[model samples]
Target: MAGLRPTRQRIALAELLFSGDHRHVSAEALHGEAGAGGIEVSLATVYNTLHQFRRAGLLREVTVDAARSYFDTDTSDHHHFFVEDEQRVIDIPADSIVIQGLPDAPNGMEVTHVDVVVRVKKV
Candidate 1:
């Protein structure tokens, strides 16, 4: 949100992403929703905007699956529950996790941060 101006389309997309409730959304899904809502944004624009939001720290990408990327608006230091069956990502509270030492990098690079995503199937 720092360098990005809130354009009409961006604001509308942001409203759809953030204003309602906390949830994960893919660019294609968002584009479909926007189209249903009568917004004239293109799919490529949605994907670009989503990536821009990720770069700006307004959204976090959930990378459980490489083929599709899910966007999250909750930028806090928390984990996620990725339901493989439903293709949903839900926040796991930060306080609920405890961390030990992380595995060392092969290149001796210091670990900047760790994101834990627990994938589960709904029974």
Candidate 2:
């Protein structure tokens, strides 16, 4: 946790993310929660912290949409289920999913990661 210093805002954000069961939340949603909890943090700060956390490997990014991004505390390799209509994200547990070899890497290129975001709409 060297890189992950628990700033007041970060601590509050972590509490929001980890304190009450696991969840996948977007920056806007987190900002709203922080506001409700009386934590004064701007939406940009929330986004910056999320990006920093992701870079520090403390959180994972779920590409749910171009305009909005979801954050996951579970950093392990896995997939996600994104409900477009509901604007919700849920984890696809590691044990419940599997991945075969990835497609061949282009010449002189390597596959750093493979993120699978399964988008679905409620019926």
Candidate 3:
């Protein structure tokens, strides 16, 4: 469980997020879900809680565009398949792709991780 104080709204939101199979969801999508589920939480609260979860290592943030971001329930190493038309994301196993020929880190910086989002469209 996340280490933050468990307020009633946080508890309800967390249940919706963590009580099922791993998924990718944006704040707007989650806000809609919360409303549909009759959880009277505000959109701002959802966004703030999502950022808190991401900082607490309970979720992974995937950025598809400057205007959009999605949070993943699965926190392990992996890539993604972004279906542009549907505005959805699917997980891609980490072993399926390989990265190479990267330049060395600059100064004291180090490369710890790489996130790849392969955008796809239906034929």
Candidate 4:
């Protein structure tokens, strides 16, 4: 529905993605799921599909660090909490935080969105 071609692979991936409640998933994890679910798809294909989905606004990419990122199904305006120990992501209550800043956008550029990822480790 995000203006992407409904290819067989995309359809399968979309089913896996949107079947349950909104969640976060990494490419590797999704590739593994597809593999286990008897879907003959390659890792590269999964990555490409994810990027395509993101470009089509079907997913939101949340980069937790330089090496790890996850695709979030919920696209609403909200931040996330990255569980460091579990390597998972969850939404932070939208009303629980407030942000104030003192910076202006660069010439000809406008601030589009702000992403806040709070990392919490096991106590």
For each of the candidates, give the backbone clash count: 0, 0, 0, 0
For model 2, give the 10-residue run with minimal summed lDDT.
93-102
- Root-mean-square deviation of Cα positions for candidate 4 versus the true structure, in angstroms: 1.1
Listed in order, each prediction's TM-score against the native is: 0.85, 0.84, 0.94, 0.95
Give per-residue CA lDDT, model 1, range 34-63, as digits (tens): 999999999999999999899998988888
Residue 14 lDDT in model 1? 86
The 10 consecutive residues of candidate 4 with the worst lDDT sum are: 93-102
Q: What is candidate 3's lDDT per residue for 1-123, written digit by digit as tens?
A: 568999988888898999999999999988999999999999999999999999999999999999999999999999999999999999999999999987999999999889999999899
lDDT of 4 by residue, 9-96 (tens): 9998999999999999999999999999999899999999999999998899999999999999998888999999999999986677
TM-score of 3: 0.94
Model 2 scores a TM of: 0.84
The count of residue-pair clashes in candidate 4 stands at 0
Per the 3 Å backbone cut-off, how many clashing residue pairs does candidate 3 have? 0
lDDT of each: 0.87, 0.84, 0.94, 0.92
lDDT for 117 in candidate 3 is 97
lDDT of 4: 0.92
- Among all windows of 10 consecutive residues in model 1, the one with the lowest summed lDDT is 105-114
Best by lDDT: 3
Candidate 1, residue 84: Cα displacement in angstroms equals 1.3
Better of 1 and 2 by TM-score: 1
Better of 2 and 4 by lDDT: 4
Q: Which parts of model 4 have CA positions greater than 4 angstroms off?
A: none
